[model samples]
Target: MAKITASVYTSHVPAIGAAIDLGKTQEPYWQPLFAGYDFSKEWEKAQKPDVVFLVFNDHATAFSLDMIPTFAIGTAAEYQPADEGWGPRPVPAVHGHPALAAHIAQSVIQDDFDLTIVNKMDVDHGLTVPLSLMFGQPPQSDYRWPCKVIPFAVNVVQYPVPSGNRCFQLGKAIRKAIESFDEDLNVQIWGTGGMSHQLQGPRAGLINKEWDNRFLDRLIAEPAELAKVPHIEYVREAGSEGIELVMWLIARGAMADVAGGPAPKVVYRFFHVPASNTAVGHLILENQPA
Candidate 1:
């Protein structure tokens, strides 16, 4: 049966993607931020998974004010990069695992978590930026992401977004769904976005390094307790966009400890500030072999 071998968490900032694409990563301002991920890229190369179940929020790219699903899963064979006001990034198209995705949708919905199954949609930096960070840029001759991806988008833009507790529970259901699948595949669940930075009004460019680090510590040692954090705290303490941190619970929920399996090994952990207007955080946790 399919298994979730690991879970990755990171911030998906569009400027980071642009820096990499523009070959500006070596610049003094951006060097440290990219340097922090050097270990993650090497670690990912050493232990690659067949598919990545990426969890992120749509920054008003796919869903607008007119339509918003609290949770959506992509079951399409392919997804294209979106043009979010600025031109689209020159990234490889994302290949999706339709069979596995469809199965997950069915199982998750049966588990009572309502999800909108999307067959076609343009993926924004919220999705693509994370892939770029992990897999790096594909060769110019053949541009394609290294592994199949199943995009799971949460509605963080809307006011009544899913709570941290709800996201955590849903992640457990996802873990159950993956284990019940018949295929024997290696999978990684990635939670992207937020370390704490707000990008709006007078509060723009706010960074709470202390709060972000504390969050990382709790997320590593006591996610169950951390999952209890309410949305208002994330907004008031971390900043408005900081509410995006709730998505991390979904990936953390799929970890081994939450499933009564072995404790997860923290393979890699990183935190950096001022990646664009957001604080960047990255983690790689692998399930200890049973």
Candidate 2:
């Protein structure tokens, strides 16, 4: 059966994608931010999984306010990069694992998670930025991404988004679904988005480092309890956009420790700020053997 080997979490800041595409990563302002992910790039090369089930929120590129699905999963054979205003990032098209994606959709829906099965859609920076962070810039000769990517988009843009606990529970269902697959594949689930920083209103450019670090701490050690966190706290403490962190709970709930197995090893943890006025948080947890 297929096994979920690890869960990766990070903030999918669009500006970071621009930094890479515009050849500005080495600029002093962006160097520190890129440096934080240096370990992640190296780690990816050594521990490349066959597939990555990435969770992110589509930023008005794929789904607008007119039609927003709380949860959507990409089941297409491949996805084109979305052209968000200033042309699409010069990134490779994302290939999907249709067979496994279909299986997961079947299993998760049977488990009572109402997921919108997306047969086709353009992937924006929310999905591509995380890929660029983990795998780095694709070479000029060949620009394909390192692994097959399965996009799982959550609705954090509009009101009435799923609660942290709900996402956590969904993660449990996803793990169960993946484990039941017959293929002997190594899979990784990635949750992208959030640290803090609101885009509009009077309190724009908010960065609660204290609160963000506390979130990372609780997420690592007390996920079940952390799942109980209410949405208001995320808004008051970490800013409205901070609610994106709940998506991380989805990845966390899929870890072995959450399901009465061995605790995962914390391979890497990073926190940085002010990337397009947002705090960037990242983590990697590798599941341990029974």
Candidate 3:
């Protein structure tokens, strides 16, 4: 049966994508940020997952204010990158795992988590940036992403977003669903978006390094406690947009340690500041054998 091999967490900053696309990664301003991912790219190569279950929030690209699903699962056979003001990023189209995604939806829904099943949607930078960071540039990697993907989008753009505890619980259900699959597949679940930076209003360009690093430390050691962190704290301390960090709990909850299995091995942990007004945080936790 299929099993979750690992959980990954990262900030999906759009400017990082711009730097990679415009051939400015080597520039002084962007060099430090991209360098942090050097080890991550190598790690991805060594741990070639058969499929990646990516959790990210749409940036008004796929779903506008008109309609938003708190939790949406993409069960499409293929996904095209959406044009976010600019033309679409020059990246390979994403091939999805329809069977596994559908199974997960059916199982998770039965588990009491409501999910909107999306058959067709154009993915935005929220999805592609993480892919590019992990798989490298389209030319350097492949015309297609290295592995199949299952896009799981969480709603963080609007008010009344999901709570950290809710996202975390859904993740456990996801783990259960994935493991029940008959296929002997290795899957990696990823939660993308945030390390604290408010995009608009008076707090624009806000960066609470102290809170952000503390958040990381707690996330690695005491996630359940971290999940209890209130939403107002994220807004007041980290910045309004920092609330996105709750999404990380979803991936953390899917790990082995959270399920009474052996603690996951932290293969990588990286944090860098001022990556296009946001702090970039990343982690790779590999589930250990029981």
Which parts of model 1 have CA positions greater than 4 angstroms off?
Answer: none
Q: Pick the candidate with the highest TM-score.
A: 2
- Sort by TM-score, best first: what order? 2, 3, 1
Off by over 4 Å in 2: none
Prediction 2 TM-score vs. true: 0.99
How many pairs in model 3 have backbone atoms within 3 A of each other, for residues 3 or more apart or on separate chains, i.e. clashes?
Answer: 0
Q: List candidate 3 stretches off by more than 4 Å.
A: none
Where does candidate 2 have its weakest 10-residue lDDT segment? 137-146
Q: Write the per-residue lDDT of candidate 3 for residues 114-176, one digit (tens) a residue.
A: 999999999999999999898787564347898999999999889999998998888899999
C-alpha lDDT (0 to 100) for residue 231 of candidate 1: 89
Best-fitting candidate, measured by lDDT? 2
Estimate, for each residue in 98-148, the C-alpha lDDT of model 2 and write its tens digit: 999999999999999999999999999999999999999799888899889
